[model samples]
Target: MADVVIIGGGITGLLSAHYLAAEGAVVTLVERGECFREASWAGGGILAPMHPWRYADSINELVFESESLYPALCEQLQEKTGIDCELQVSGMLQLALAPEDEILARQWCERRSRVCEVLDQAQLQNLNILSTQFSHALLMPETQQIRNPRLGKALLAALQTNPAVTLHTQTEVNVIETEPLRVVTDHGVVSAGKVLVCAGAWTSRLIAEYSSLQIKPVKGEMLLLKAEPGLLPYMLMCHGRYMIPRADGHILVGSTQQDSGFDKTLNVETAQLLQQHAQDVVPALEGAPVVRHWSGLRPATNDELPFVGSLPDRPDIYVCGGHFRNGLAMGPASALRIARQIVAS
Candidate 1:
C-alpha cells in the first residue's frame, strides 16, 4: 500500500506528492486528465492576496507565508526539473475609478503597513500606456506574479521524475472506497494509508457520494494577448478585474466570476467584457489581438475558505480544494501544511 494517495493532479495534488515523496513516503497521484491541464494551467498566476484587507486574519497569514515560500519553491523546482517558473516580483497597482474605492484602497495600504504609493492624475499619466480613467491608484510593492503554465509543466515533470512517486493519468476516480482509504477508479482500485482529494471544481460532485459538503463551482473567463515589451510593466487592478504582463511578450487579461456550475464555455459577453476592461485599464491594449480565450471553474465554499485538514467523520480522508481564485498563490504552503499533517499522523 502506498503511504498516500492524492486524487486530482492539479497544483495542490502535485505539490502534495512532491512534498510527500521528498519525505521518503510512497505516494501515488491519480488524475482524470493530463496533469495541470485544468484550472491550474488556466490561472493568471497573480500571487496577490486578492484584496488582502478583505480576507480573514488566518487567510492573510496563510497567503503571506505562502508568498514567502515561493522563492525557495521556484528555485528548488527549477534545479530539479530545469524549468523556469518565471517568478516576478513586480508590484501590483490597484486603480480606483470611484472616490469610495480609492479611499478603501488607501485604508488597506495603511493598515497593512506595506510600501504603497497613492498616485494622483499626474502620476497616473506617467503610466501613459494604461487608461487615464482612474482617479487614484494604490501601489503594493510586496505582491508578486508567476508564469503558471511554466510552473504547472515543471511540477508535472518533477512529479514524473520522482522515483518515490507514481502518477496515473487518464484515470478518473469514480468513487472513493474508504474503509482503509482505497479509491475506486475506472481502471481499477488502489488503496493507500490516506487519501487527499484536490479535485478543484469537481470536488463537490465527487465528495457528495460520501460526504455532504457543499462545494460549488465558480466559473471564470480570461483572455490572453500578445504584446511587445514595456507595454505594461506592472500588474494592474481595477473594477474587480486584473491585467498581468509577462516577460515573454504575453499579457493575461481576466476574469469574470459567475455561478454557472461546471460550464467551461467561453461566452461572447465575457470575452467582450474582458477586452473592454483591459482596454479601459490600458488603452494601448485596445488593438492587441487576443491570442486565446478560455474559461475554468474554481471550487468555492460558502465561506470562501478552503476545506483543508482531515474530514470530520473520516479522519483518514483529507481535502485541499475550494481555493477559489487564490489556488495558485496559496498552493505551495497549503500543500506543505497538509503534507506535514499527514506525516505526523
Candidate 2:
C-alpha cells in the first residue's frame, strides 16, 4: 500500500501528489478522465479572488495566502520541469460601468490596499480597450494569470518523472473502502494508508455512499477569441463577467454561472452572451474570430467555501473540493494544507 491515495487527477489531486511525494510519501493518483481536462483546464486561470472583500474573512485570508505562494511555485515548476506555465503578472482590471458600481468598487478597494487599487476614468482608459466602456476601475496589481492547460500538462510530466509518484489516468474510482483504506475503482483496487478526494464537481457523488458532504455542481461557459497584441494587455471584470488575455494575443471571454448539475455541454445563448460582453468591453474583439468554446463544472458549497481538512466521521478520509470559481487560484495552497493535515495526523 502507498502512503497516500489521491482520488481525482485535477489540480488539487495532482498538487497533493506532488507535495506528498516531496515529503517522502509514496503517492498514487487516479483520474476518471484525462488529467486536468475538466474544470482545472477549462477555467480562465485568474489567480485573484474576484472581489476579495465579498467573501468571509477566512476565505479572504486563504486566497491572499495562496496568491502569495504562486511566485515561488511558478518559479520552482518552471525550473524543475523546464515548462513555461506562462505565469503572467500583468494584473487584473475590474471595471465599473455605472456610477453605483464605481462607488461599490471604490469601497471594496478601501478595505484591502494590497489586493486592489481604485482607478479613475483616466487610469482605467490607460489599461486597454476597457476605457470606452467604464468610467472607473479597480486594478489588482498583485493579481496574476497562468495557462491552466499548460500547467496541467507540466504537472503530469512532473509526476511521471518523479519515482515516488504513480499516476493512473482514465481510471474511475467507484467507491472508497475505508476499513482496509482501499479505493475501489473500475479497473482495480488501490490500497493506501489514507485517501484524499479531490474529485472536483463529482466530489459529492464520489463520497455520498460514505459521507454526507453537500457539494454542488456549478456550470460555467467560456469563449476564446483570437486577437492581435495591444488589443488587450490585462484581464477585465465587469458585473461578474471577465475577459482574460493570453500571451499569444488571444483573449478568453467568459463565463456564465448556472446551477445545471454536471452538464458540461456549451449552450449557444450563453456563448453569444459572453461574446457580446467581450465585444462591448472591447469593440475591436468584434472582429476577432471565435477560436474555441467550452464549459466545465465548478464544485461549490452551500456557503461558497471549500471543504478542507478531514471528513467529519472518517479520520482516514479527507476532502479538498468545492472551490467554486477559484480552483486554479487556490489549488497549490489548498493542496499544501490538506497534505500537511494528513501528514501531521
Q: Which candidate is the best by lDDT?
A: 1
Cα lDDT tens digits, model 1, 102-161, are 566667667767778877778888878766676667888778999998998888888888
Off by over 4 Å in 1: 97-101
Give all TM-scores, in the order shown. Answer: 0.96, 0.95
lDDT of 2 at 251: 86
TM-score of 1: 0.96
Task: Give the range where candidate 2 is weakest over 10 consecutive residues by summed lDDT.
Answer: 96-105
lDDT of 2 by residue, 39-85 (tens): 99999999877666566767766677777877787777888888888
Model 1 poorest ten-residue lDDT run: 96-105
Clash count, one per candidate: 0, 0
lDDT of 1: 0.85
* Clashing residue pairs in candidate 1 (N, C-alpha, C atoms within 3 angstroms): none
What are the runs in model 2 whose C-alpha is more than 4 Å off? 97-110, 126-128
